[model samples]
Target: MIADLFPHAQPGAGLIGGVMIGLAAAIMLLGLGRIAGVSGLAARATGIAGSGAPHGIAIAFILGLPLGACIVASVTDWKPATYSAPLMLVAAGLIVGFGTRLGSGCTSGHGVCGLSRLSWRSVVATGLFMASGFATVAVMRIAGAL
Candidate 1:
């Protein structure tokens, strides 16, 4: 099973991955009384919220994402493969924001916590999320955009 996941699996990578995820979720829930739904947090930061945590903390978490990636790269041999230009990245962010509003939650909510709770809506939302991602990748590849 582990071999199926990574042909060149590094020792303790799976354990480290699971620990990181658990720590993130636990910290979010414990400190904020909210799920670490990245999309919801992003929306709130961009003025789409009624009330929430101090904007600074949310912004910090958002900013820390890239910082954390850089830190990992510093410690390991990892680097970002490729990404869109600034304008395209902005457009993608807007589209993602809109989609999260339409979908009522992000992957962390629907695909992680809600699904764990056996929520039917979550099940459907997760399915749609996966399908849409697959479709997007396929369409982009077909158009030579990937």
Candidate 2:
């Protein structure tokens, strides 16, 4: 119905998702007094690192990601994207993990939560990551790999 009502409204889904993320971040901040950084939470959950929040909370938060995705998949007519190769997927995951560690946060941490609070570190990190992403895409396109 929505797709039919607005044939070109592709941004609607993204906008809604962004708003939901912001709300979740805000709740984490205001209610729990913690930054909703997924990388940090995951690290804490796995005993790789510790944040100010308890490990149990972090574990629950980490678990909620897939649970939420599953719920959304059940209710919505959405499908996950497929990659060309399993090796490529593993490589991408490794790169992303390295990047999150290097940057000290992921996109959700810096782009959504950090930027909202006007953190200079996050601003610089987000800008650098965004530029790096664009450059990566450009290079991939030139190499006919994307």
**Per-residue lDDT of 118-137 in model 1, one digit per residue for the tens?**
88999999998899899998
In angstroms, the error of model 1 at 42 is 1.8
Poorly placed runs, candidate 2 (over 4 Å): 1-9, 50-52
Q: Give all candidates' CA lDDT scores.
A: 0.80, 0.88
Candidates' TM-scores?
A: 0.73, 0.89
Tens-digit lDDT string for candidate 2 (65-135): 99989999999998888866989889989998878976889898998998988999999999998999999
Best by lDDT: 2
RMSD of 2: 3.3
Model 1 clashing residue pairs (backbone)? none
Task: Write down the RMSD of all candidates, one decimal each.
Answer: 3.2, 3.3
Q: After superposition, how far is residue 43 of candidate 1 from its true place, in Å?
A: 2.0
